[model samples]
Target: MSEWVDVHFQALETCGKRARSAANMLTVEDVFQDSSAKKPADAAQASMFGDLSHSGALAGKVNDVWSALKEELGTGRSRLQGVEKAIDQVETNLRKATKAATV
Candidate 1:
């Protein structure tokens, strides 16, 4: 029993693939494109509101959140892939050890 190694390879592979797929779904620019709201906000301020500071601040915060999320998604994908690779290596090593013991 001690010699047997139990690993759910399919689950790990699926998790890694899903992580990569999720990260690939959104670009950094799509997450938080600077200058995207700038023109519109500036125009609105120039035309109507003399003070758009609060609105600008809110937008900034939203952008910050999006940027952080985008970064985390990439990081998560890398970490998931690393975990999968590590698990695969462990399984391979276990198999080799078992085969050698049998021989």
Candidate 2:
């Protein structure tokens, strides 16, 4: 392989590794919808603040974001696979060209 092609292919391999790592870093969680906010226990606070019931709301929102990010990460992983396959095809074509020239 020519030095230029070799370098470019190596760079692709490195990029693929980085992409995979990034995908793995995003974790999926059980996302849920926020239920109706319940009335607060503190009657005075409840009156002052109204319904603020959601103990689960914050968790649900976080999980929802995590799940979305995980899906996006899966798409990125698929793109990385495509890049790897394209690199392989390019290398194969280069080798074939070199063989034909020598023959």
Candidate 3:
């Protein structure tokens, strides 16, 4: 009965590791720098719409996207933590059940 539990625990460990890796893939600094937004946004606005206004609007939009991505990544990381905790509980219960059966 507990053989499948061992396999499931290993699978959860792998899934949690992959989720943590995905979560670390993005950061706030990876999006915007400390300098004025106009320079960074200039490249984007120029490519999208030639000679567009460097009014920082495009920068705000880009930042919004990155912020949302980072938030989602944070959620994913938290979920992985939850999965690890679940594995712990499952392992504990399986051990208890086995011990009780032998008794």
Candidate 4:
């Protein structure tokens, strides 16, 4: 039983690490778009499953790390949306500033 627990714990850790890495990649990709238009929030949602390999383990939540990772991803997605919105606002302000300067 102990060995089995250890195995599952290691698996959970590995999943968390992979999820974190994928989250990083998604973040970079989301920000690196060719166009300046804001992406949908669902675009961020699309990243949440990139690293998930074990549906059974995720459903079990035996170690509770899976839940934590889900929360982390959710927070990361929200942060990405906020950053995108801020970027749009900044770009708009810059355009206005440039126009005013030209005037």
Highest-scoring model, TM-score: 3
How does candidate 3 score on lDDT?
0.62
Top model number, lDDT: 3
Q: Give the alpha-carbon lDDT of every model.
A: 0.57, 0.59, 0.62, 0.54
Name the regions of candidate 2 deviating beyond 4 angstroms. 1-52, 55-57
Compute the lDDT for candidate 1.
0.57
Which ranges in model 1 have alpha carbons more than 4 Å from their true place? 1-52
TM-score of 2: 0.50
Tens digit of per-residue lDDT, candidate 3, span 12-53: 667756655654543445434554552233333334644568
What TM-score should be assigned to candidate 3?
A: 0.54
TM-score of 1: 0.52
Per-residue CA lDDT of model 2 for 64-88, tens digit only, reads: 6655666886777677667666766
On the 0 to 100 scale, the lDDT of residue 64 in model 2 is 67
- Ranking under lDDT, best-scoring first? 3, 2, 1, 4
**Candidate 4: segments with Cα more than 4 A from true spot:** 1-63
Pairs of residues at least 3 apart in sequence or in different chains that clash in candidate 4 = none
Clashes per candidate (backbone, < 3 Å)? 0, 0, 0, 0
